[model samples]
Target: MSLLQRLIARPPPPRTAARVAVATELPGGDEVDVLWVRDPRARRLRLLVSERGARLTVPLRASQREAQQFLDVNLPWLAAQLARRAARDVRPAFGRGDPGPLPLRGQLRPLEWREARLLRIEERDGSIVIQAPPAASDAMVRRALRDFYIAQARRDVGRWLPAYMPGLPRAPRSVRFRPLSSLWGSLSPSDAVSLDLALVLGPPAAFEYVLVHELCHLIHPNHSRAFWREVELRCPQWRALRAWFRGDGLALKAEMKRLVGP
Candidate 1:
């Protein structure tokens, strides 16, 4: 690099005058550079990186050294995760062409646009179908399916709770929706089951497997042999479904993200 080229290189922005250590090493074994992003509305530190640079946006109340140390310890894990994410990358299958028909619960269903007020499921000439009314936009279709699936999931779970665990108290009384980036669902001790809305777009088998797994938790809170035995008894194909989800979860999650907007 010539001295003239160095002199012509851009200088740091004023907001990032204070330097911080970055969380990852670059491809050439160089430590990545960090830029401080301060926003008064920020309530915590947010670290993000891109080809341009690594950025650490911090709240006014944050302890810079503490945040840096935390990132340092987690750097390798973060890098590995990011690498995996980069490897399993996907692009939106929407607008390019029809994603064509999708299978739901062992039935082939086509997604169609119609001008109607309600999102509905109906059987048509020996085929089960999901339809969005003509006024329905992609966002509406996505949201309606999410709501329908979660509600149906709640009812389905409610029905099995009693049959599986006779005389069990409360019967898994409440089912709730939540966004979980890691797992599909969770069952709290208070009879509340939190389901990931993202699972609605997964393969039908994966969706059912997760629902059954969480519902089984109402009886066995821990993943004990008895709990798994219960899962196997209720969902015989669970192992295969689990393996499928493991391979496809990232792709499904990416689709969900696109539907909801990244």
Candidate 2:
């Protein structure tokens, strides 16, 4: 009985090969970590590049060699992307005598910092005055500035929300603000609208565009043709506004990063 049972069981067929990963150095001397993933549903190989690094997704039948080959072929593109990311992360030193004005509401507003008993920000005569405590550090001053922007975003977004509501299927249940890293705005399935506080640095037109974009999502959750049509119908100049946000808005984000790391 024991002999027959052992012969029939066959030790669970010796299991398939486990997934593996390896690190390889690019021609530019940058190291890339490659993961060999087994995705049953994957129809073909795909490469994803990000600030962190590059990732290769492969089908179950693919080998580690294939993944490595893909990385080798895409090394140039990967290197350029990594270089751009490195440059983006290198924030300019923000202190006395920095050139130009601070970006606020899509315009370069004069930045004035001074010592005071408490931190306070005020907008007077086309200038943003920031008063920090005597012992306040740069990070502390940055925090105060961020808080000011968040408050400003809240006020501005609230004012703009009402103007776009009549075009939507129904007004959002609520509007909220957050300091988001990667998203300008998002519409929840529960009818809540959340906007990025960093958006306060962008132009008023860009802010209005984002608000309208999220509002359209209340009717069509996906970016289908119908959803975009609705957006175009409501905001005819949305295309230009979007282009401005992508170009100028990114500059604002980089400046904010310089002020407040990450």
Candidate 3:
């Protein structure tokens, strides 16, 4: 190694694990640990590194050599992730207004608001509609929508749980709402359901569809044929409804953000 290289002490290159391992390179140092896992059912190699650590989730067929190559190629990405985590760890505040434009459903939109009671929805005869109170500023409107989704989840999630899952013998232990980036709702195996607050700002039908989808999970955890059949039983045209949600209902989140300003 050159004098500069030796003095700088380039962290050792990541090493590949054994063939039995899913395939990923070893982390350079203890500052950030790495894990490799092979999933027979996985279609492709995927990497997930968060505040906790880095891990490789890849197809079982991937060889250790391939895993190591993948890790080497993604070294810069992994290092950047570590840096981001380090930065976030020192973040100063929480619950800041306008968490900067967040994605509601699929569209990215700005969230702005003030305090008000009226809940209004506006759309220019298109896929996305803005839901907020006229007097309520953008921030307040988002807050209202957030509150609305939470209240609705409490009422809606439990109603369908027992109906769809008769074997449960009792109502779901708890139902709650939070901001979820990707899904409208999720059902936990432990009888808990979490609703995404963004849903409250979505169309009424979207809310219903989400309610139906999540409740079905109480009985069927996986997206198996039986699970879809259950969803169909509740909303015969659920497929079409979901399509509408993807195309239209999902955009309400963006609409709300844009129309409601800081």
Candidate 4:
């Protein structure tokens, strides 16, 4: 063969498939859908378990057999995680009567509900009192309370940004509040900061830490050493605050979910 023909006839480099699907039976006879994804950036096999099921990400050179073996080794852990998620999915009811003490600004404040002509909320003598229309539905009352929480979070987080990062290059484009499921706060590409309204129900320190964490993201987009160093520079006690969020924060989220029903 000519030299040009020989060069052109060489076989193409081997490439792993982008994604493959498999199924595995759990200990309880439940079948879980496993997606095997070939990620060039993946350094090792990683398992992501969620309510949607588990996904196994492996390096491009890894095999399906290796993926199955990895899942087999971690079946117990996966089962436990699925069990925990199932427990969390069981929603609790929030009665119309006084909902008891609620976390506010790092303390538990008694929550009182009253019916009136107008919707009003007030913090009186370490208690949060809500007054709404006599005929308002539970959803309406919950919305009012949720809005109140958003207002509080907006005020506190707005005040904190300046105090925490006095040397920030520029003020954030905007600060928004919303009901977020799995995040405390996020810094958007448009330079806006979105905070979960539920954060107001956690400890004040935790809220502050979340604010600092997101603001640092404005500088360092990833969770690299530089980002953590910035976080430490702003909130030195951030680890303890994070621990509080991981422990007590779950209770706060559950309570919020119970009250809001989502």
Off by over 4 Å in 2: 1-84, 92-100, 245-249
Deviation of model 1 at 59, angstroms = 31
Please give the lDDT score at residue 126 for candidate 2: 94
Over 73-114, each residue of candidate 1 has an lDDT whose tens digit, in order, gives 656644554565565456453321245454334344665534
Higher-TM-score candidate among 1 and 4?
4
TM-score for each of the candidates:
0.51, 0.66, 0.43, 0.69
The per-prediction CA RMSD against the true structure, in angstroms, equals 11.3, 8.9, 11.3, 7.9
Writing each residue's lDDT as its tens digit, candidate 3 over 1-262 gives: 5432231233222343222222233355434456665555455676655323567765546665575678788877777665655554553321324454443334444544333355643323223233444554545555544554355445654565556565433456666776554356788878787766556555555677787787777777777788888788877878887766544432343333333321
Ranking by TM-score: 4, 2, 1, 3
Ranking by lDDT: 4, 2, 1, 3
Model 1: CA > 4 A from native: 1-103, 106-108, 117-141, 151-162, 167-170, 200-205, 260-262
**lDDT of candidate model 4 versus the reference:** 0.71
How many pairs of residues collide in each model? 4, 0, 10, 0
Native RMSD of candidate 1 (Å): 11.3
**C-alpha lDDT of residue 188 in model 2:** 89
- Give the higher-lDDT candidate: 1 or 2: 2
Instruction: Specify the highest-lDDT model's number.
Output: 4
Q: Which TM-score value belongs to model 2?
A: 0.66
